[model samples]
Target: MEMNLDSVKVVGFDADDTLWVNETYFRETEERFAELLESFETKNKIDQELFKVEMQNLDLYGYGVKGFILSMIECALQLSNHTISNDTLQEILDVGKKMIAHPVELLSGVEEVLQKLENKYRLIVLTKGDLLDQERKLEKSGLSKYFHHVEVLSEKKEENYQNLLEHLEIDVNEFLMVGNSLKSDVIPILNIGAKAVHVPFHTTWAHELVSKEKEKSTNGYLKLESIKDILDYLKH
Candidate 1:
């Protein structure tokens, strides 16, 4: 479907994966988590069960490292029938601490893209995660100056985007969302009559993966190779 940028005024960006390294850390942590539980279950089984736990806890813990750590702890206890060692539990907590402490690594040309668009349009961050953790990353990113607003959403859905636009007083057709997840970032905005740009990251969470059929049916979005390409698309 063709997208018209002529009406666009406000640009929203997704935090993890889209602007910086995020999902890769989760994948790495899952590997470590699987290893921690290897004695009770195979690596593959542990991985599957962990995913199940995360999905089940989405409402309770929401998203981010804290929720992931809790899910890992719960999975470990279940896999071991409540016999998992305290040391292993501590190790699981350490895994989350390490992830939380990791420095924010911005994607290539992220700052440049933000700089290019900063003055031309109102820019904001529309991301879902632990509020404190998302705020910490934004502070560390040093790109906070580029955004007029930063919203840490509990979830990303059509209604969430609609409310955000209303809160910001932006017309649906005049807002463009840029992010890496088709499920969270692209599809919802498209469904709400807003434009979206899909800047894909190499590593995606299993939960965010949409079926090929679902992807094919989505419209009113553009797919670009990198965040930097957004400058070319929107700067004309």
Candidate 2:
């Protein structure tokens, strides 16, 4: 990985989970959502149905707390056969609002890693979600000063990375993406001929899970236990 990243000039970081806590909130919300509909169905069933609704509405709503809230509402309506009370519905909205209003929790060693790499590399944030929400989080994180650019992508496929890199005038060979999700951060960046470092978070959303075979096939990307470990490879 060090050999591959020796030429890297720009480092793209994934915002949620990589730099700070994110999926844990969604998990907590899911538990609350399940409880809200517990009388209608088992918690397991509610979780499955809500996930299905979210997947069904993915293209329509994209990824973010807003879409998740809508999915939960839809699931509640379906699970309760349209008999869901207005008060319960309001509670769902409040839960999502709370997630949005939740404070940013930076991961361990995140600031230290960013600070060390800031002068050596052009740091940028490339994340996918609601633009306004992402920007709001970045502002609250107070780590935005270290980045040269911040992009809120609707998706993180190869083309998205390719286009953004091209627009930013960064060569793929000279770029390194560091993030938590292998599906979003590592795999796509590796596929695009760029270098990537996988810094796994304790919790990952189901949509971001990759198969073991898929993980094994991908070569050249480094998987580290902590973000701070990257300094050993990238630091001069």
What TM-score would each prediction reach against the true structure? 0.97, 0.98
- RMSD in order of candidates: 1.1, 1.0
Residue pairs in candidate 2 whose N, alpha carbon or C atoms collide under 3 angstroms: none
Worst 10 residues of 2 by lDDT: 1-10
The alpha-carbon deviation from the true structure for residue 207 of candidate 1, after best TM-score superposition, in angstroms, is 1.1
State how far residue 227 of model 2 sits from its true place (Å). 0.3
Question: How many pairs of residues in model 2 come into backbone collision?
Answer: 0
lDDT of 1 by residue, 1-236 (tens): 34569888999999999899999999999999988888999999999999999999999999999999999999999999999999999999999999999999999999988888988999999999999999999999998999999999998999999998998899998899999999999998889888999999999999999999999988768999988877777863
> CA shift at 65, candidate 2, in angstroms?
0.6
Candidate 2 TM-score versus the reference: 0.98
lDDT of 2 by residue, 78-180 (tens): 9999999999999999999999999999999999988899999999999999889999999999999999999999999999999999999999989999999
Q: How accurate is candidate 2 locally (lDDT)?
A: 0.93
Model 1 has an lDDT value of: 0.92
lDDT of 1 at 142: 96
